[model samples]
Target chain A: MIEFKNVSKVYPNGVKALNNINLFIDKGEFLVIIGLSGAGKSTLLRLINQLIPVSTGQVIVDGVRMDTASGKILRNMRRKIGMIFQSFNIVKRMSVLSNVLSGRVGYHPTWRNVLGIYPEDDKQIAYKALQRVDILEKVHNRASDLSGGQQQRVAIARALAQQPLIMLADEPVASLDPITTVQVMDFLKEICASDGITTVANLHHVDLAWKYATRVVGVRAGEIVYDQRPSQTTKNQFIKDMEIVYGRPIHHDEFVIEEAVV
Target chain B: MSDRIIVPPPKRLGQTLGILTVILVIVASAIFARFNIIEVILGLQRGGRILARMFPLPGWFGPLMETLQMAVTGTFWGALLAFPIAILSARNIVDVPWIRVPLRFFLNILRTIPAMVFAAMFVAIFGIGNFSGVIALVIFSFGLVAKLLFESIEAIDEGQVEALRSLGADTLTVIRYAVLPQILPQYISYTLYAFEINVRSAAVLGYVGAGGIGQLFERALAWRRFHEVGELVIVSFVVVLFLDFFSAKVRRSLI
Candidate 1:
């Protein structure tokens, strides 16, 4: 379980990125955070892994106090949390297998990873991760040669290789086309459910959030405005209610019509 | 549309004045330095005779070959030294301001001094030999490679580094798995480019008694062996040309 108690994050420049945030995330729950461009959604995701430190209160992950973890403790904490980015941050020049194996860097000695020497089991784990993501055929190909959608799959495989308990995806599908977006999001949702890993994703698309989220948490100007499941309100009412979170009405195009998705 | 049209382009007075001032300074300096156009014409006429004597060469191959050797050896060692220093000096990689600052300061000083000056200084300390020449070239190219390479290192896509860090990889592991792979091609390209430059500079280092073909050039000049001097120049020119061609191809392939 991940719990945030009165978490307030203030940047060095004094921007209140998160304001008195109180939340709890259970294992195997797929939570999607929705907000405007500067609504502090990404900050909230980064804070979980201590990528961004909370200014006040505490972040306790799986019964360990993450805010105070240092050195080995901090690294060990980071190892169990897999995060993917909007840009699909796989090293372009490396073979897809190597990029996936890089996710295993925390488990091995520095010399072994540096020299590209890995135990057979780690290679097997990487291959399996790729296989799970359905990109095993591209394992030996350079990451750069893959298309954006394929590359994002490679990034997912890398994160899976970590065997993480929590997966944080910060706008994972923002850069992808609509079709690729649906495919990647589906893959992510299926993997999280099967592995029983809690996932927190920041998504600007209301329809995607509504479709994929088991529960949706709304953040606006760095504070939680609405937190509920899809069943709490009908799709139409929730769409109208999202105005308070966005400070404006949702556009017609923004609505994820069931037909478009189907 | 009228409101948009009302806005005028920025004035060119400052730019025009700046261009005019640069031209004025160049002209003034040329006049102040005697602007000897006639002397240059007459000097080229004399230079033609010297070029003419260089054909049907005699005993010029040995020292010319030695000079080529010095550049190759020096560039090899210098490039090796440059790799770590380049990594350390890149501000993006080394978070500590103290380390990058002092290292850049030293690199600046090294770069400011020419390769020939290094050869001269080393010759005074090590005496006339290929050792001094090679050492001088090493220091010279080390600075060149480090300066060029650190900038490329800094320009690398930092997203890969952050990804490695997110995976719980430490600093050195981040460099090996993340930074090195991205910058390796650029680093090799810079080293090859430095070698191309070093070969040309190495041919001149013999004037300072730092060894190689420069010593032969100096000896032939002293004895008025104009033909021999011509031979050395041709050999040196061809060797430099060949090295430039070879290294350029290597750099192109590397990048």
Candidate 2:
């Protein structure tokens, strides 16, 4: 289990991004955090991986106190938790295979990875991950030559090749078209189900959250306001509950038209 | 749609004043330096008379070859040394201010010392020869290529670096994967650009007893052999022009 105990984060400029957040996530749960822009959803998700250092309180991950860990220990924890960004930050100058193989760098010696001496087994793993994401044919292609959707798939394959225990996606589909959005979301959902990986995603569209989330946690002004299963949530609740989060009622366009019937 | 934004014209007060000041300074400096157009015109006339004897450039093989050899050797080693210097100087790659600060300060100090000054120093240390010229050119190239390359590194897409970090990459691995690939082409182009410039600089390095075409030119001038000096100038000009063309083409392909 992942636990955040009275965790708080305040920026150097005194802007509080998270406040006294105590939460628990089970091993195989698919949790989606939804909030308005800068509503602390990203902060809360990042806290799990210790990407953003906690200003106060303790963050215990699988019984290790991550807040006090340093150097290699922290990096070891981070390697097991795969994170993807909105921009699909793949190195454009590299081939797709090299990009995926980069995910395995943490597993080897520093000098080995620096020299780009990937063992045959790692290459096999990278290939299998690419195949899983259905982008194996583009393995030799430069990342810059790929389409937006294809790039995200490549990002996903890179994360998968890490063999991470948990997956965190920060608005993975915000840049993608509607058709490709569904396709990428389906792949993530399928991966979470098959691997039983604890998945946490920050989603913008309300309908997308409702479709994918086993549990939805709403954050507003650095605090969790709504935490419930989708069966217990309604359209009116999405507005009334998120009004404090968004500083207004949720708009219509924020919901995808083709909402999945889960 | 109807409410069009009216853009105001740029206020040129500063620019106008700046141009006026520049012109005023130039005129004042020229006058202060005893500006004499008649003397300059007479000098140009004498230069033309000297230039008329330079047809069919002389066989400048000996000194010309020395200059080329010095530039090539200096540039090869200088370009090689610049890689590590650039990596250490780049702010994104080396976050420690102490390391980067000292490296940048040293590079600035090296660059501030002109190539002629370096050649003189090398001549003092190693005595008059092509070795001193090569040393001077090597120092010049190292400073220049490192400065340009680090700036390119700083301007690269930093998101790739962060991505490598997310993969638990070490500092060296991050540099190899993220920073190297993005900046390699630009670094190579800059090195070639430096080589093109080095050839021109090497020609004058012989002035300080650093050995090159300048030594031959110096000897020819000492003897008042205007025709021989003219021949040397023509040959040097042709070689520099050809190197510039070839390097320009190569740099274009690199970028």
Per-residue lDDT of B138 in model 2 = 95
TM-scores for the candidates? 0.86, 0.84
Model 2 agreement with the true structure over A25-84: per-residue lDDT tens digits: 889889998888888988887777776789998888767788887678877887888888
Please state the CAPRI-style docking class of candidate 1: acceptable
Where does candidate 1 stray beyond 4 Å?
A256-262, B1-58
lDDT of 1 by residue, B5-118 (tens): 121223466788899999999989989999987898999988887876866345666777788899989999999999889989998877788898999999999999999998
Model 2 error, position A187 (Å): 0.9
Writing each residue's lDDT as its tens digit, candidate 2 over B120-213 gives 9989999999899999999999999999999999999877887777777778888889999999999889888888888999999999999889
* Candidate 1 positional error at B48, Å: 39
Give the lDDT of residue A112 in candidate 2: 89
Q: Is the docking of candidate 2 incorrect, acceptable, medium or high quality?
A: incorrect
All models, RMSD in angstroms? 17.7, 17.3
DockQ each: 0.23, 0.23
